[model samples]
Target: MKVDLFTLVLIVFALGVCVTLVDVGTLFSTAEATVTDETEITSARE
Candidate 1:
């Protein structure tokens, strides 16, 4: 069996998109946690 160029390109593009989405999701969760922690620390000081 032989694979064509278009099929390869499509597969690579799909994988890249999946990876990007996962990274963005992880970053957003991390930022949210950091904000919550900071708020707790500031309130505790008062």
Candidate 2:
């Protein structure tokens, strides 16, 4: 078994990036849903 520090760091960095991207995607979807709900409410009121 031979592993270097750089390889470990690169693996960790890639995981972190994936997690961040997923988080961003979730936030955007939530925001979009909220906006859609608000629009529906407004339409109902009118």
Candidate 3:
């Protein structure tokens, strides 16, 4: 029973990590898009 509980804890931890990684990736992607848009606008003005 102890072993089963330990395994459950590990699985939950792993899932939390996976969700955090995905959120980080999404944030980075949004930042990149915003930068690209700003660059395009600046170039157009010039």
Candidate 4:
């Protein structure tokens, strides 16, 4: 199993997009949030 630099960068970028989506999802979510999730949203805003 081998990966080139371009492929690694793509993978990292994709993961970051996924993380950003999750953060936004949590922000718009109406359900109860844990302290950790709240802190994550707060930090993401700053």
Candidate 5:
């Protein structure tokens, strides 16, 4: 099997986009969890 330069570039770009999207998603979920946890803690303290 053989891949040309253009094909390789496309594959790399696709992988980069996927990784970036995953990172953003993970950051959002983590932030949401932290906020929820803080709210629960505050409510409990009240």
Candidate 6:
């Protein structure tokens, strides 16, 4: 079986998009956790 250049590019592009989305999701989750921790620390100090 032979693959065409356009098909190959499309597959690569899709994979990259999927990876980026996953990374963004991870960043959001981490940011949320960090914010929550900071809030708790601040409130506790008061």
lDDT of 5: 1.00
Cα distance off (Å), candidate 2, residue 24: 0.5
Off by over 4 Å in 4: 30-46
Q: Write the per-residue lDDT of candidate 4 for residues 2-26, one digit (tens) a residue.
A: 8999999999999999999999888
Instruction: Please give the range of 10 consecutive residues that has the lowest summed lDDT in model 5.
Output: 1-10
Which candidate number has the best TM-score? 6
Write the candidate numbers in order of decreasing lDDT.
6, 5, 2, 1, 3, 4
After the best TM-score superposition of candidate 2, give how far the Cα of residue 18 lies from its true spot, in angstroms: 0.3
**RMSD values, in order shown:** 0.8, 0.6, 2.1, 11.1, 1.2, 0.4
Error of 1 at 31 (Å): 0.5
Off by over 4 Å in 3: 1-3
Q: Which run of 10 residues does model 6 get worst, by summed lDDT?
A: 1-10
Clashing pairs in 5: none
Question: What's the C-alpha lDDT at position 34 in model 4?
Answer: 71
lDDT of 3 at 10: 96
TM-score of 4: 0.58
List runs of model 6 lying over 4 Å from the truth.
none
Q: Per-residue lDDT for 1-46 in model 3, tens only? A: 3579889999999999999999999999999999999999999999
Clash list (residue pairs), candidate 1? none
lDDT per model, in order? Answer: 0.99, 0.99, 0.97, 0.87, 1.00, 1.00
Candidate 4 weakest ten by summed lDDT: 27-36
Q: Is candidate 3 or candidate 5 better by lDDT?
A: 5
TM-score list, all predictions: 0.90, 0.93, 0.83, 0.58, 0.82, 0.96
